[model samples]
Target: MFGGGGGGGRKPLDYEELNENVKKVQYAVRGELYLRASELQKEGKKIIFTNVGNPHALGQKPLTFPRQVVALCQAPFLLDDPNVGLIFPADAIARAKHYLAMAPGGLGAYSDSRGIPGIRKEVAEFIERRDGYPSDPELIYLTDGASKGVMQMLNTIIRNERDGILVPVPQYPLYSAAISLFGGSLVPYYLEEEANWGLDFVNLRQTVASARSKGITVRAMVIINPGNPTGQCLSEGNIKELLKFCFHENLVLLADEVYQQNIYQDERPFISARKVLFDMGPPMSREVQLVSFHTVSKGYWGECGQRGGYFEMTNLPPKTVDEIYKVASIALSPNVPGQIFMGLMVNPPKPGDISYLKFSAESKSILESLRRRARLMTDGFNSCRNVVCNFTEGAMYSFPQIRLPPKAIDAAKRAGKAADVFYCLKLLEATGISTVPGSGFGQKEGVFHLRTTILPAEEDMPAIMTSFKKFNDTFMDQYDGYSRIIQYYITPSVKT
Candidate 1:
């Protein structure tokens, strides 16, 4: 009945005929600028890649306890060996054995479509401890990474082109890329740069109103606590306000809390949306739909390559939960080793565990170093000519606003690039510092910025910042200085 051979004449997929949605997706984290950085690396240039929040690639040492447990799980044969304890700590061996028992078929075998049940339990416990609220294992779904979970939820919500998701302007490019790929509208609410990139409730209401006026049905609101690029951790008070807004507006809350543990500012510590909702009690907790996401890719552990993450749903209808499960079942299973890593991350060595001391010291050192690097990079940008950056309160990035002269804007126009993109290209050429332009992250028009991770090695961070300062000082002087020279030449003869 099916004309299989008839499709043979269709030739290779024509770029012109490809899905327009696919064509619309643009992940600036690995966009044209990233490609150029890769080219420079191949040509033997020393490039400091701050394009994405990839910590291990930037020299962050992996937490030993997780790696040890995972290494044993990867080769279960070693666990049975009598002398395996000689090389591995008792707690790690025990933990590995516990997880191995849960997955009798081993890490190589397929897990539940959701994840390893035991590990999911551990994640639930971790959440309970962190938020002082109960989290259900059945509601949690382990994903290949938080990004996969985000796309899955987006797919569930975006039934058609007019379905809109309220996303932050200057957001992680993944949100934009996923919205485009799924053929959904992205309604943007801008964070106020004048106020440490904080959210403004009035602005949010206006954005939502604007989207609805255009006939788009706004479905969900995404909040990246301890935000990416901007790195502003949402206070608990702020989270409560967001919950109220979502409840009143009947919008789902998608909280991206991957940077929960990366917080550096005590005054603005990380707070989960789930916690705030329950704290508000009654109507808000019982009715407002919420989906909270976490990943092993971020924070001090920095297990980006492992691709372990999870999202917990709250207040969703049973049928909706079943549908999400059905979609996950299509993937067969999440990454098994990644699930194990997620377990370790959520339930690391406790006080009496043999590896506790080493784990504590290692994780603490990494975090302290990152805190210092965050300050170093922020201060470096502030000191640079025509550049001002907010302090990185949590996430691994510094988004510095660069005030360019008219001449630079003209140059960028002639080169057929956004002003910031042109400036980033020039920065890469001069100092091999690869950063994503603000245009990539959907900044407010006429204002330009760039995103850089503070993940470089601590010893080398100073030198990196110094190198960036040298190049930036020269860039500003060349572009911003041109205006002064013209102004001097045209000034109506100043009578002494």
Candidate 2:
């Protein structure tokens, strides 16, 4: 009627006409709570954005050398300016010149779909040094970010509705989202939250068996070391068990190691899945397929927006790798500048380099600050009347379980929200602090949690925790039968 082709018909891409799978994707990190917080911010409310693991957004300064190298590579014309030497450190300039030489068209050019060969080689060397095993540059796929690599692998693995991937409960939500997007089943294996979110082989075996009983072919299993949200590092023993499980189950292992550099505890230092696999020797190492992912987004680099990441594939057949290459080639290329940033991340300044002292100092300061913040957040949560938090051994998040009483659960029902969601909304409204509800990340029945980042400024963390406590105390009193009485009934918190 309005001179359109369909004459008052519904929009060509109507809601109901959209892909069913698209409608099923749920990423709680930026779900209702984040949206509400954003709306509040728009209305002039001061809101602390901690719903996701984005560090740079919370005022993390980019490392000097990376920015320098990326900037130089982005504008290689500066190298010929002669005065460029005055502005950039010699090492950064030299590194920029090296990458520029590798990429003839520079950052603006579409690199090889597998990423710049030179950068892939750099990543391989980084992996070799990291895992004590050889990495083939041909197997390294530099992604726009680690997330893109994840989706790509998911795409490659999930062939039909019958194919399933074993994902951890209390996952990052990326796996669930991707599985839905690709129209595959997400078979959940619950991590023992009480065990500091450790993997349970019995749980794994049962979950895989259950999936099989339902005719779901379990294709792969994802392991996030120094886990997201939960933030507990996997012990090397856990990895060994996981590899054995994968070998016996004939499942591929997808290791998300984005937070390898973010460990906060010496007792639970980060261990790579590949390292454990190889250390276990022949059949398991030689037979179990593995893909390990890493990114510059989460570490001290905090280059979230920089989109620099790579995943190294081990034991994948040549044809399958070729098919993945074809899928990547469809995108033409990964982000060029991102690849450069990743190169700098894997190969930063050495002790003798001019930028070494400053790089080391900046990285150290950020890490130490995170360490302190993790401690403060954990202790602060444990001190709360109706809250229990395991130590954030690594990663940038602390996912604390909220001990909501029956009355609070009923109140949440009345509010048309999950108990944790209602509590998070209340916390946000009361304290102007934003967080992701536990329901967003899958949790066991009767459990409720909220994930908050430890990325706030160190000085501000104490005040933030204090504010959270004040609001939580009042919230518990108003809904959870008053803290004093509730405390008597509640079990003593566990210390891991």
Which candidate should be chosen as best, given TM-score against the real structure? 2
Q: What would the per-residue lDDT of candidate 1 be over residues 307-366, giving only the tens digit for each residue?
A: 999999999999999999999999999999999999999998889888999999999999
Error of 1 at 342 (Å): 0.6
The CA root-mean-square deviation of candidate 2, after full C-alpha superposition on the true structure, stands at: 2.3
lDDT, model 1: 0.90
Off by over 4 Å in 1: 1-12, 482-496
In model 2, which runs have C-alpha deviations exceeding 4 angstroms?
1-5, 480-496
Please give the lDDT score at residue 22 for candidate 1: 93
Query: All candidates' TM-scores?
Result: 0.95, 0.96
- Find the 10 residues in a row with the least total lDDT in model 1: 487-496
lDDT of 1 at 63: 90
